[model samples]
Target: MKKTKILILSAMLVSTLFSCQKLVEIKETDLIAGDVALKTITNNEQGIIGAYAAMNVEMGILLNAVFADEVVTADFYNAATVHEWQYTSTDISIRDSYTAFNLYYRIIDRVNRVLAALPTATAANATDEAKRSRLRGEALFLRAFCHFELYRYYSNSAVGTDLAMAYMETPSLQPQARITVAPYFQKLKADLAAAKPLLPTDFSGTNVYRATQAAASALQARTALYLKEWNDAVTFSTEYINAVPLASRANFPGIWTDANSSETAFKLSRTASLGGRIGSLWRATSASASNIGGITWTISQKLWNMYDQANDIRFSSYAKDEPLLVGSGRKYTRLITKYAGTAYGTAAENVADAKVFRTAEMYLIRAEARAENNDLVGAAADLNALRAARINGYTPVVLASKDAAISAIMDERFKELAYEGHRFWDLKRRNLPVVRITADLPQVNAATTLPAGNFRFLLPIPNAEIQANPVIQQNPGYTN
Candidate 1:
């Protein structure tokens, strides 16, 4: 099937708050926009590389800007104390998030343009058919991957009977601006399925740095689980995990710190010239030249204490020392240290790939699915494999029942996937209680529940999208 360009309005048209760096720029005159560089076959390869590069520029600031403060409110914001009914009305986060949404759409636009151009380009003719197919598959997988992330945040919860947020399929040029949740998942699933067969089993000769079949499988599993397709979740996740071995315990830390690695399924590539890096931008202390100055977020003391011992390698990997500005107020004895480097300082700006999907996540999914399916023994074994790998001096999992096993799985996911965008979704998906907190406000009761139709869970449809595409309605709660 022919792919449609899904460009939204130009970033220039959006509110001024999100004007960080252009998410997708394709000026032929400037090599960075990925136009002239990707005009030919060899250049097309570079263009693909550049497309992945855009993710770093788009996500680096946004991740720290939105996630650091929003996800772990209990750590810094006293989220547990504030009532969800009373979050900041003028939250800078709203504006920051709007900008991120704009940037991500732009990134998707570029990937679409590349996918569109690839078929007719000279590069398409010169490369072997298999190589070409692999490259195209990587692009599809990536496009689907980004769209999925967009859906999760922009749309409402898909729990019980509620459908997810509307999916954005058409590029900005098309008049059909929004599609419903059912169709959105349909399109995302199709893209993932199409990409699956074309992708290589493992990275080899070419497309090594791009998404492979395993990556696509991993993505399929993720999307499936989000839609609550337990069996499909088990199948695809198993496929992904079986194909790509998990990162050895010793090298786990390196996956977060560096750009290049065999274990990484798909990452946004960064370089000194491109102006993006996860580690340096997220730096806690000024000791590093590339440090972004202030550390915006720190690992929660609660999480830090959860580690079984002082000697666990995973704990040390994420622990860093930095001064903090807020709640339980004190300097962080150890900030999240997984991202450590000056390769992409705030100014020098090296680009790095955002690690989207990895093998470890698959294990977590399998554990969750099995527990949900009432296979307690199967679930415990999967969870234990990872726990043993990350924590030394581990004891065997002891839960004998399914409910106990499931709780263990959630806690394991919290620790394993910490800081990796899963926490917020997990909380929302399970329909857990969310209490917004504050340093200055009155304490909210811990037992306050997230109402069934709470609007905050869904981001108001981006204001810019509403203005440009009149058909795009605001999500249930936010003011247009």
Candidate 2:
């Protein structure tokens, strides 16, 4: 019996993942039997690296910015296509949607391959067996994390019946139907549960880049928030918080600068050499000698104003008033400097490690979960703690009601997670609209009000996948 080369999508790259570079395979088969390809502990460990390379969160970050009100196209040129919200029409903003869809599944496929090879792969000693087990856990974690990402982006809502992604465990070319939203998450939870014990409790050199017990818990905390499993959300977030406290005021800026990994639960290793920078998404590729970046996107003035510029540390940490000389004059535009690469302030290298999960987010999760659970005092404390760390001379406020606490938590999330990519989905999770600042509308040149439950919120399956698989269904409103 021959194995099916399960293409993650209609056309997917069979790229080599050593040293984090892509090399296309031109072979009759995209397979080497599991035992041969991953015959040893080293082989299995290295196989997981490919999954990490293919896991690109930057695509989702791009979608979160362009589709929602967090950003607007620069003054003259709209670098990317402005989104068209109608179900049947081509939307430029969401053009990256299919790319995101394709990427997550590609990650899943890479993970599954690692997993499929594990049982038969040789581990010569107890140390090797321990390492192998950890690899298996990390593979499972990646699968759960990627599936959760797809579920949030593609599902209309988290309701049980809403159509979500096909959760693939075993690799196969057989066509798969979309699973419902509920089971999708349940499967994700099961994978995480299986992954946790096999994973290490600590973060070491390269393991810091790989998923650990902390990272798995972070996923659980976040998933609980989405499912409104308030108690679990609070419990899991508190678990991460207890382990890694918030980065201090002095150290807070360093997290963005790649100066330190103070409260980082997990991050993707990106470098000038290995090259998976996220900065180019907001910055133009080429810039003249006089200017730093030909900034393609800027934080919406509305978002910019929300920052306490002088008082809030995030104001400087997330962006800068990038001064550019314009025709014998100087003008300052707010540039998203979050991904300013390893060169930091100078050189505009536009690359940096992608911080996938941080402890600060746990605080926010605890806050949101507490709010929804009507633990108003606890929610306020969590919210206040995060704000106090990020802001100078911070003053705490009481959230008189659960609604007010949730609202405040939303604002905190915006300020905390701006360019790091949570804005759009945060609103979508709450069934809230993408309410843009009136002035922000013309800057984007597209729908300013994306009401909750709109068809556009659910990204259509990439045409490649739809045309490739007979059993697949296009998302509810999108046409083939």
Candidate 3:
């Protein structure tokens, strides 16, 4: 372990330094300091709670908003640099990402602090060994999860190619710290492996809110696929699926709206008026009206028509009719109502706990890995199982070949996991050529296709970080 300095002021220390919103402050006196001022270790339960607290401000909100549909509105061009034609590595999107990144890293730092303090924690009987192990596992899984997501979106990593983005190892307390991509994933993989055995089987015990062993398995499955570990991907995903009670078709959509359902692998359980609400930003509004953040977001027409086919459940899950407000005369396509029944104001009043990892994804991951491994029969069975649960009368798919099985799994992934921030990555992972349909009608507008090497795939490093940290290298094809 590195000997770093630890500063335990009020969390007001962070707010004073960062000028972020008025979030709840973790009491400072409770933290225990070791010899190195750079690190603080605490055996308190609050340390574990603090690890979970890092999810919102640090990463989820910004990543979901930007990656979900992208900033296509005309106003986006003016409000944010990522949308502007003059794209740079040091743009605000990249900069904003630093704060988010720091959030996760901060959690990781705290986890490490707790680990360093573990010897003393154990001696004093301040923590139960089993409970301590479970908490440690949760922290490891979260650290790996956040880093993996950052690698995919920000770093340049092509599907099935060796030229993906570098991964970060330690969360640098300093503003800008550099970590390479390969080593980063290695650390994540190692962390996840360590945590897998220690984590509890029932993470969502009463609230489906925390990470469990199943979540660790699901995450391992995702990371394996990203690293091209096909067999490992299948293994972990299979383990996760085996643990979950498969959902019936009629209960599919409820997985998103009704958090109480068994289908949710892990969720951020935010009761009404409790946590961050994404619905407020996504609710239907007029084209002419400014977006909630002075930037209006609409569902992509191309994404909409993908569901127009018969028996496509996503058509309902991802879309709605746009009246100027809620009930104006003019009609257009609004994003599918993932957050349903709850009004935006009510939803936004409290943060809806973010659903970070779910079981539905493991099924798709298994299907993809099985197809890639030339197990077409196995792949088809998995694909059909997920479909049978969604489509009222889905006919089982018969695969004569691997390619056909792959196609079926991809389609199922599109339907089952659409708008959950997985499609863009799924397409990227498959190395599929993406054609952005920018035409006004959306079904067919501008057929802008980027080859597999298009630089757009690599998110520009947060510009501010690049400027602040000289060691942090800009991803290839983007400017510093």
Tell me, what's the RMSD of every candidate? 10.9, 9.1, 9.8
- What are the per-residue Cα lDDT tens digits for candidate 3 across 1-480? 122323445455886766544333544576645433322223434576667765653143334334434323422223334332234665665555434445555666766666655444542344464466666677677777777766766653523334333344443455444455566677778989998888777755653677778888888898888777899999999888888866765565556566455666677655544535555444433232333222245555555565534575555655565353354322333544665434443433313446666677888888888888988888888887877766666788788888788877777766666556666556666777555555422223323554565565566666666766776666677875
Order of all candidates by lDDT, from best down to worst? 2, 1, 3
Tens digits of per-residue lDDT, candidate 1, 64-166, equal 2233223233234433212234433234445543344665666677667667656755644545444566667767777887788777766634543344444
Best candidate (score: TM-score): 2
Tell me the lDDT of candidate 2.
0.79
Residue runs of model 3 more than 4 Å from their true location after superposition: 1-43, 57-86, 97-100, 122-127, 156-182, 271-275, 284-295, 308-312, 322-333, 344-351, 438-447
Per-prediction TM-score:
0.76, 0.88, 0.78
TM-score of candidate 1 to 2 decimals: 0.76
Compose the digit string of candidate 2's lDDT tens values, residues 321-437.
Answer: 754534534233667878776443344378788999988889999999988889899998998899889889999999999889989989888888887778888888888888887
Worst 10 residues of 1 by lDDT: 65-74
Q: Rate the local accuracy (lDDT) of all candidates.
A: 0.61, 0.79, 0.60
How accurate locally is residue 229 in candidate 3, as Cα lDDT from 0 to 100? 85
